[model samples]
Target: MLSIMFYIAITAEAMTAALAAGRRNMDWFGVCLIACVTALGGGTTRDMFLAHYPLYWVANPYVLLLVCGAALLTVAIARLVDRLRWPFLLLDALGLVVFTIVGCNIGMEAGVHPIIVIVAGMVTGIVGGILRDVLCNDIPLVFQGELYATVSIVTGVVYYLGLLAGLPADIVVLIALAVGFPLRVAALVFKWEMPRFVFDREMRK
Candidate 1:
C-alpha cells in the first residue's frame, strides 16, 4: 500500500534524525541497527500479522538502503535538527496514520469487519513502538500518553468510515493523515490527556 510506504519513509527519516541526535560516538553498525529497527519494525509486525509474506523490505531490499542513506544523511544535517523537531514529529504522525490505514486495508482484504479493522489498524501502529520502548528501557508512551492509543483508535475509525464512504484511496489517506497527525501533535503541545478516573474506582454494593 502507498500509505504504508509513505509511513516507512517517514519513520526512516525520523529514525535517522534520532540516531543522529544520539550517534555521536556510536559505530556504523549501531547507527544502521537503530535505523532499521525504527523504520522497519512496525511494518514487519503488521505484515507478520496479516501473513503477508516475504515482507515489504525483503521484497524491496532497497528499503534498507534507503534507511541507511537517511541515517548517513543525518550526520551531514545534524545542526538542522533544532529547527526540525516539529518536522520529525509530523513525519512520525504521518507514519502512524498511514500504517494504520494499511493494516485496516489488509483486514478488509481478509474479510474482517469494521471493528476488527479498527483494532488491527491500531495494533499495526502501536506494537513496534511498544517494542522500541522496551528495547530503549524507557516508559512506552503508549502507556503514558493518554492520547496515544486514543489517536490510533480515532484514526482507525476514520479510515474505516472513509472506506465505507467509497472515498478515493488518495483522499482517504490524505484526510486520515491530516486529521490524526494534528490531533496527536495538539495533544503533545497542549499536554491534553484523556481522563483516567472516568471509570469509578468505588466497589459496588
Candidate 2:
C-alpha cells in the first residue's frame, strides 16, 4: 500500500512539475528533466544524506520512466490539468506527508538519531519542490512561509512516536497521514503561514 501511494505521489508531483515546465516554455527534454527532479530529487537527497547505497530510483530505474511518462501525459492534457488546480494541490499535500513517512522509515532503518529522522523526513518532503522552483527560476515555495516543511516535521514526529509506542507500521502510517494531511489542507484553506521576518534596511556601500 505504501509503495502504491509512493508511486501515485511521485506521478502527481511529476505532472505538476511538467506544468511548471510548460509555463516556462521548456521543450520536451526540459520538461522531462524538471519532472524527474521534482519527483525524485527529495528521495535522492535523503539517500545521499544517509549514505544509503543504491538510491531508490537507482535501484528501481523504472520510476524514471514512470515520472517521464506522467509528465508527457500531463503535457497532452495540460488544459484539463490547469483547470483542476485544487485536485493537484491536494495530491501535492498527500505527497508531502507520504514522502515524510517514507523518509522517517529510512532514517529509522539507518539507526539514526531521532532529530536526524525528523530532519531527514523534512528534507525528503521539501527538497524536490525546492529544486523545482530553483530550476524554474523562482523562489522555493518552502521558503515562502508556507506550511510545507512544518507539515512534514509534524507527520514525521507523529509517525516516529507511533512506531515507538509499538503500533503496527501500517496503522502508524495511516495515523500520520490523518494528522498531517488535514493540517496542510487547513493551512492552504486558511492561508496559514509563518510570520515573515523582513529586513528592509539597505546596506551602506
Candidate 3:
C-alpha cells in the first residue's frame, strides 16, 4: 500500500532525472515505464525472494495508475525543475524512507530474524537505485562511498529495534523516516562519505 506509493514517488524522481539527463524523453510512455520500473524494482525483488505472491501492482492496478499519473504530473513541473533539485532529493529520500519501512514490515511478516530485517531494509532501499542506475547507464550513487545506503541500513536498524519495543506500525515507520530522511539530506548537503580503502599504501608508489 504505502510501499507502492513510495515506489511511485521514487519512480517520479528518477524518471525526471532521466529526462533531464536526456536518457529518456519526456513522453507519456517513457515517463510511465521509467517510473514503474525505477520505483518498484527493489521492492519487487524483496517480494519475489520472500514469496509475497502476485506482486504489488498485479494485486492492485491502481498502483500502476498512480505511478503513471505521477510521471505525467512531473512533466508539468519540468519548467521549474532546474530550481527543484533539492525537492527531487527530498522526494527521493521520502520514497527511500517509505520503502525501507515497508521492507522492514515485510521482513517481520516473513518471519525473518532481526539482523536479516536490517539486511532486508537496506536491500529494499539500495537495489532500486542499482536497477535505476544500471538501466540509465549512470554511475550508481550508492557505491560512491556516499551516505546513501548507510542511512537506509541505520533506519532499518531503528525499525527492528522499535518493533522489538512493541511500537505501533505507523509509529515505527514514522520514526524510521524521521530519522532516515534528514540524515540522508544532511549527508548530501555536507558531502558526507565513508572512508575508502587506501590499500595501506599508494598503489602508484
Alpha carbon lDDT of each predicted model: 0.72, 0.95, 0.74
TM-score of 3: 0.84
- Candidate 1, residues 64-121, lDDT tens digits: the string is 8877777767666666754677777766776777777777887787677778788778
Model 3 clash pairs are none
lDDT of 3: 0.74
Candidate 2 residue pairs in clash (backbone atoms < 3 Å): none
**Per-residue CA lDDT of candidate 2, range 1-205, in tens?**
8888899999999999999999999999999999999999999999998998799999999999999999999999999999999999999999999999999989999999999999999989999999999999999988999989999999999999999999999999999999999999999999999888887567533
Ranking by TM-score: 2, 3, 1
- Residue 25 accuracy (lDDT) in model 3: 48
After superposition, the stretches of candidate 2 with alpha carbons farther than 4 Å from their true spots are 202-205
Maximum-lDDT candidate: 2
True lDDT of residue 15, candidate 2: 98
Highest TM-score: which candidate? 2
Q: Is candidate 1 or candidate 2 better by lDDT?
A: 2
User: For each candidate, C-alpha RMSD in Å?
Assistant: 4.3, 1.6, 3.0
lDDT of 3 by residue, 37-99 (tens): 776777788888888777877888777776666667667666666467777778888777777
Instruction: Let me know the TM-score candidate 2 reaches against the reference structure.
Output: 0.97
